[model samples]
Target: MKIYDEKHLKNIVLLGAPKAGKTLLAEDMVFEAGIIHRRGTIEGKNTVSDFHDIEQERGNSVFASSMHTEWRDYKINIIDTPGFDDFIGEMIAAVRVADTCVMVINAQHGVEVGTELIWDYIDQFQKPVLFAVNLVDHPRSNFDSALQSLKERFGNAVVQMQYPLNQGESFNAIIDLLKMVMYKFPPEGGKPEKLPIPASEKEKADRLHNELVEKAAENDEKLMEKYFEQGTLDEDEMREGLKLGMIHHEVFPVFVTSAKKNMGTGRMMGFIDNVAPCPAEAKPELSADGQELPIDPSKPAVLFVFKTHLEPNLGRLSFFKVISGEVTTASELVNSQTGAVERIHQLFIVDGKSRNPVDRLVAGDIGATLKLKDTYTNQTLHAKGYDITVQPITFPEPRIRTAVIAFSKNDDEKIGEVLHKIHHEDPTLMVAYSKEIKQLIISGQGELHLAVCKWYLENVYKLHVDFESPRISYRETIRKSANATYRHKKQSGGAGQFGEVHMKVEPYFEGMPEPTEFPVRGKEVIDLEWGGKLVFYNCIVGGVIDARFIPSILKGVMEKMEEGPITGSYVRDVRVMVYDGKMHPVDSNDISFKIAGMMAFKDAFLRCEPQLLEPICDVEIMLPEDVMGEVMGDLQTRRSLIMGMDSKGNYQVIKAKTPLAELDRYSTTLRSLSQGRARFTQTFSEFSSVPFELQQKLSKQLQEVEAV
Candidate 1:
């Protein structure tokens, strides 16, 4: 393989909704470049991208696959990403490394919920974007409607570059607005012949051509003057203006293609080679400290790992982008995060699962290397002594959680080990043991995401598991003040243990006044790890209880707080005052005082009107207008408080605050209710008091559990 310079390397990521034909579009591109003699279909399971077993089984891309094609003088490195929102982490990682984003829109369905969700990431990165209307030859395709939706959703930056002549099953021609020519493709759909625009389509073609010219000239002053002086700009001039417009995200050029039949991929590839912005021309990457890291070959070598895969029987493969300088097989770089020296052993330019060994890769180029220690996704490797770390991609938090159990008790530990390995490959899949819930919890984007993890565990690791709803982490707190007295005495042998504690407990709030009934000699405020605070005070007068014993008493109070007497949940936001206590100088010790204090606190808490606090989450659901009524009714059933509602283009956004317990399996429910036309995000809001009736029921359940 030949090496391309920074300016000649253009990296693009294919993104869109599922069934939008992104994988096929990538296949068509590689075939048009002559990299492959024949194209592969998703059904045939032979496509260069989507080569994974899971993708083939599901007929969808699950992981982002890398491929490169040489078009004209430019080397376009393509990263084909999964369209399902479940694998959004794969898409974000690809977007962070790519210079441009080509959103493949299905002509039959314009701007789907998945498409809108993916657009948020593209807009956030501010990457130059363009549209490729795929499946234009389908009988249900509507190119005009798709183009209109794009313009309405994306605003004036959208400009038309090409349009289909016939547009349905008989689609065979496309009018190029920039070149003012007609591309007539043969029935076989390759190597189109350029001809003059016919009179029947000339008027419509001329109007769109002028619009394209004006949109291009608006980006550069020189191009504008040329267009005004000569009444038109040449092809090269227009290309220059469009490239500048793309670089600044001022324009999003649209092109039509039938990727399934390979009708218009060649023209689109030609345009990408000529007009797309190269990696070097893109905005400079920012360091972790927010400093600009310019793309300069003369600078020290720096590479950023964007994705990693654990190939079956092949060890780990790390995919990276050369951000600055050139990397070769012999170079030794230091991991900025780990500070360990790693020598590059093998480097290759990847095309899906196929890797072509390369001696060197320059800045602005993407490639893969094998067997690097102490490096993974979002880590930066730089030349020794050059301290620079690139800002890592910010992945979204998991929205769904479940407790997983291995089928056999012997595989419990093994399941955890395998899950950690899985989490290493995909960060979005979170696995951890929740001590409060006493269950092994796994969280992810949605049900499908976790289902994929289960599939891997069963098929790849041979560990069968079951998922169950995880127990909620509830908190217990007091709502009033109460007092109790307890005396711990033991006389089993010569030395006896005796201690008495008299304490008052009350609900705690910030900036509350100190207790005036007893003199406050010492106070220790502790911030609970789960949430809230615990305040302890020593109010004994005249050394009624030794100062050293105060800590023992406080420890006992904390022990009771760990397992609240009401519901056996963690207790928070309460203050305790030990006003008086009796101790035997000979038998009194930390243990004696701890027991007395614990008993007294528990006795007082039961009489303090203890309440339960459950976790609440802020949920935002986006759905089509037609299904708003049904979705709203469902939310009401879930005890959701309608915080607000807003309109976003063709969708409705509903914001609600709901108890975490009621949100179990909500992602699956929402998908079913809206027929996959809706998407929602949830975040922890706060912990609030549970209703009296629910609290009574939970307390009764806890009593039953304790009895068992």
Candidate 2:
């Protein structure tokens, strides 16, 4: 391998819908570049990207795989990312470091649900994108329709750079519009023989070539002036203009490829190496302090870890991109977040599962290293004096959740450790123990996401587990004000305990009126642990109760608040005022007052018309318009309030607020309802009261659980 400068290095990520031939295309690229003697197929489970055991068994990419190939004096670092939304974290991490994204669209199916999903993220990162109309050799391939679809979804910026001469069953060659040459490959497909464009297709090729040149010229002033003067751009000028167009996202050149047949991949790689933006040309990354961190080898070394994978026999593999300077073996860097020093023992440029040891990784290069003591994904490693941290990737919140329990008691203790390790491998898979629900909740993008985690735990960790619907985190709150009195009397020893409490409980909100009896002896506003506030008023006048015992009384009220009086859910938004109370001279200690206070608050809470508040989430579902009615009706049954609706390309987005309890298996349900064409995202909104009809049922269930 040769040491290439950042200008000669191209970091590209292959992204698209599943079965769109992304991994296959990557395999073809590597083989064409002579990095591998033979191309590996997904079915054979020998592809470099999908090397994980789970991925091999599933026959799809479960993680992002990094591999590089030297082609035409350029080091092209290719990252093949999983198409499944469940493994979105991998796609996000890869796209974050990539200078250009090659989004592969299935010629047969065109843009799909998965394609749209990944496109949203690509747009979010604002990375330059090139489209590869792949699988053109498939029997049902429709080049015209696929091109039309791309234009419709992504606008007219999608201009053709290459087109298949004979698509589908007889797909043999592609016409390169820029050069006006035809690449005619053999039936078996390898390198192509360059020939002049056929007279029959010359007219259409000329029109497309003009469109490409015009799109390119629009990106640069010099190119625009030259195009105006000469009526067109020459080959070199067009390539330079296209590179500028791509960097500014003013043009997205679409190339044709039959990855399986190994047709047209070489031309695509040439275009990427010659036209795609390099890492230095990419937008400067911002540090945590909002300072621009450019790709400069002269600066102190700063590497950002984007992904972490736990290998079977080997330990953890941390994939990082050198943002500045260079990293070599034995380079000492400090973890930006933890401030722990890490000595780089070795540096390796990854080629699929193979680790190619390199002496140093220069700026803008992606590589992996083993066993960093205190570094993980989204963290930065920098030279000691340089206190810089790259902006972290923001992953989507987990949509589907299930309560997981160990199959055996021994496995119970190990589940936490195993889950932590799994989380390290894929951050999208989240594990949380909900003390309120008394269950360990494991959440992910969808059912398949969680299923894969379960498989890993059982097969890899030998910890069998079962999953069920998770319990919703409902809350309890009062709706009205009420007053109550309680007397605590205990006589067993020399000093008897006696205390009386008179307290008023009322619903509290910001700007609410203060209690009338307050002389302002002591005032404290305690933020509730759950989600609201507790305003405790000390209206003790005339020295009826000592002010020192006020905290003890408030403690008792909080204990009751933790376990609400109506159900066992945590309580919130209630104001308690111990306006008056009786205290015995000898026995009215903290314990007696606390007990009396607890009883009084409980009695008052019961009379105050308590209500159960379930967590509400804002859900945005994107699906084909045909299923809009069905989905909206289904949401209605879940007590959802449809906020609004909008349209995006061929899909409709329905925005609604629904209770989390109603969305237990919504991911799976939505898939089944829309035949897997619908995708959704959810975030926590405000909590709302559960309906009266469901309140009785939940109370009964709580009682049964408590009794058990």
Candidate 3:
């Protein structure tokens, strides 16, 4: 293995739909570069990526995997990321650190739901993307339709670089458009033979060659002039033009390959080395001291840890991209957040599952280290003088949640420790204890993602976790103002306490949704400023109630509101206007009034609507066009509203909003309906009052479940 400098390193992140042969392609790349002896299959339990046990069992890449390979004298660090939408956070972390993305698509399926989601992430990062049409050997695979679909979706910038010579099972090789030579593979796995253009496909070949040259010429003035004078540019000039266009993003090259047969893998590697942009071609702005810092490979070491892996005995191995300067083993670097310096130990370049020890890594190189004291995922490490936090990988908020309890009480304590370690490994996953349900909650992207994580917990931690469908954190509040009274009298004390509180509960709102704003934080919980102020007018004109006792009653009311009027959830945005009260001067104290306030609030809240507001999530279901109608019907059955529909190629992106409660088992339903061809992503939307008819049914269920 060779280590390249900053200007020569090319970080490429491989993306595609699940089961799109991305891993096979990664294995093929390693084999083609002579890094590995042979290509490994997903079934044989041997592959560069998807090395994790859970991933191999699932037969899919669950997390991003990195491998270093050199192509044509250039070091190409390829990151093989999961294509499933559930593992998008891992892809995001990889994207945050990569210069270009090579999106692979199944030639048979074309642009799939997962591919569309990957495109959404690419758009978010605004990085240049290339398309690789893999598995071209499938019987159903069509070159024209697939290539046209990609061109249409990506705006004609997508031009075919290598055209398949034969279709379907006859697909033997690829025609190198730049060289106008056909590399034909022999039957039963012999070396490919270089042949002249076949007579039968000569006309088609000429047309495709002209299209490629025209596209290439548009990106270069010299090439365009050469084309006009000689009707076509030479191979070297055309390659140079395409290279410039690709690096500048004016052109997106579409390569054809049968990843299973290892066809065209060598050509793809050649393009990646000769054409893809290096670190110097894709330098990003570095922030330092509230300003944009220059990217200098000669200066002090400043690298960002974008990914983390928890190994069995290795502790935590963090993957980072060097932004500036070089890092040698045992060198000291300061963490910008904690301002504490720590020495780098065991600096090594990752080669798939193996680690190659390296003395030093220059800027733009991705390397790993074991067990840093202060550094974690997304932490910035630099040589003392630089103090700036690098931008972290931004992941969407977890929309789905499930409450988990120990299947057996014997594993309760162990669950916490396992969950804590897993959460540190993946920042997207959130773990919390629900006092109401008395269950530990683990929330993430979808049911499948959570299911996979649960499998890891049970298998890896040797603990059982019982999962329950998520319970919406509904809030309870009063509608119209109500006057309530309560009196607490305790005679079991040296000083008998007696207090009476008369208070009105008025509705308060935030940003005027009319009733209340949803995400009310700590301050509003105690002092709700939405409706009217809690006027402690102290109308005890004769001092029947001491000032100390009045504050006590108010405190009690505040405490009750925090516990909610209905369920034990937190209450918000409602004011307790304390108008009048009576108390004995000697017995009355702050504690007495507080008790009075609590009693008064409970009485008033029960009388008002006290309705439960369920959480709704905005969902976008991307499915093939054939299943749009069926999907719409399924959504409507789940009380979902179809906001709108947008079509891209053969897929339909249906945007809808539905209650989170109704979507608990949607993953299963979608799998059955679409035959595992459809997937979706959902996020928490506004919380609306449960509809009148549904409210009664939900209320009954709430009582029944709570009772059980």
Candidate 4:
């Protein structure tokens, strides 16, 4: 493999909704470059992208696969990403390393919810973008509607560079607005014949061409002046202006393609080679110290790992982009994040699962290396003394969670270890042991995301597992003040245990007045790990309870708080006062006082009307306006509190606060309700009190479990 310089290397990520023909487009692109003789279809499961077994089995992309092709004088590294929201982490990683994003829109559906969701990231990253209106030859393709949707959703920056002369079934020609020529492809669809624009289509083509020229000229002052003086800019001048506009995200160029039929890809690749921004021209990355790090092969080597893949038998493959200098085999670089020296044993430019070994990779190039002991996703490696670290990509938070159980009792520990390995590869899938619930919990984007994880465990690791609803991390607190007394006495042959504790318990709130009636002496405020606070006061007059035994009593209170009397949840936001107590000088010990304190606190807690507090989540749903009624109705049944609503294009945004217990498998239900036209994000909100009846029911269930 030949290593290209930063200026000649172009990295583009294919992004769009599911089933937008991205994998097929990728196959067509590599074929057009003459790297392969024949094209492969998605149905054949032999495409250059989507080579993973899981992706081939599902007939959709699950991981972001990398492939490269040399077109003209430029080497283009293509990252094909999955469209499902569950795999959003893959897309985000690809976009972070890509200089440009190629959003492939399915002409049949126009701008879908998936497209809109991806555009949000594109807009945030502010990278130069271009659109490939693919599948234009399908029977249901509607080119005009798709074009209109782009313009309406994306504003006037959308400039049509080409359009199908005849869409759907008979689509074989495209009128190029930039070249002002018609490309008529052969039935087999490899090379195209250049022909003059016919008289009948000249007027419309001229109108679009002029619009493209104006859009391009607006980016550069000199180009705008030239357009005003000469009536129109020349081809080279227009390309220059468009390139400038693209770098600043001021204009987005659109082209038509039927990737399934192998048409128009070569032309698009040509434009990409000529006009798209390279890494040297794209936005410069910032270091951890806020220093600008430009792509330059002469600087010390610095590489950022954006993705990690663990092969079944082979070791880990770390995918990274060289941010500066050149990386060669056997080059030792310091892991900036770990300070450990790692030698690059090998370097390869990958084409799906097949890796082509190369001696060197220059700056701005994306490649993979195997088995770096200390490196993983989002970490940076650089030469000694550089000490530069690239800003890590911030992944989306998990939207759903569930408790995972191993089918066999002995596999529980093994299951956790395997899941941690999986999480190492895919950061979006988080695994942790919840001590409160006594279960191992796994969280991801949605149900399908977790389903894929289970599939991998069963098939790849030979571990069978099942998923169950995760228990909510509720809290316990009191509502009023009450007093109780407990005496612990156990008399044996020697050393009798006798201790009595008199305590008053009350609800604790921020800035509440100190207990005046009890003559508060010393206060200890504890910040609970779960949530809220615990304030304990030593109110004994003349030391009715010894200061030494006071700590033992507090310890007892803490034990009971850990396992709340009402439910087996953490207790928080309450104040306890040990006003008086009795301790026998000979028999009283730590254990005796501890038992007395625990019993007294528990008795006072039950009498003071303990309440159960449930976890709540802030949910934001985006769906088409027509389906809002049904979605809102479903939310009502879950006891959701609708906060507000807003409008974005033809979609409605609904924000609500809902209890976490009621949101199991909600993403699947929303997809069904909206026919796959809806998307949502969930975040933890403040905890709120559960209803009275629900609290009673939960307490009864806990009692039944204990009896069993």
* Each model's lDDT: 0.92, 0.89, 0.77, 0.93
Question: Each candidate's TM vs. the true structure?
Answer: 0.98, 0.96, 0.91, 0.99
lDDT by residue (652-671, candidate 2, tens digit) is 89999999989988988898
lDDT at 255 for candidate 1?
A: 93
Q: Supply every candidate's count of residue pairs whose N, Cα or C atoms clash at under 3 angstroms.
A: 0, 0, 8, 0
Clashing pairs in 3: 552-590, 552-593, 552-594, 553-593, 553-594, 556-594, 556-598, 557-598
Off by over 4 Å in 3: 188-191, 283-285, 288-295, 408-414, 434-439, 509-542, 648-650, 692-708
Encode model 1's per-residue lDDT on 230-337: one tens digit a residue: 887888988999999999999999999999888889888888888898887898899999998878898999999999988888878999999999999999999999
- The C-alpha RMSD in Å for every predicted model, in order, reads 1.4, 1.9, 4.1, 1.1
Q: Who wins the lDDT comparison?
A: 4
Q: Rank the candidates by TM-score, best first.
A: 4, 1, 2, 3
Write one digit per residue (lDDT tens) for candidate 3, span 523-562: 2234443222332223344554565566666578667755
165 in model 2: Cα distance from truth in Å? 2.8
- Cα lDDT for residue 297, candidate 3: 86
TM-score of 4: 0.99
* Error at 434, model 4, angstroms: 1.0
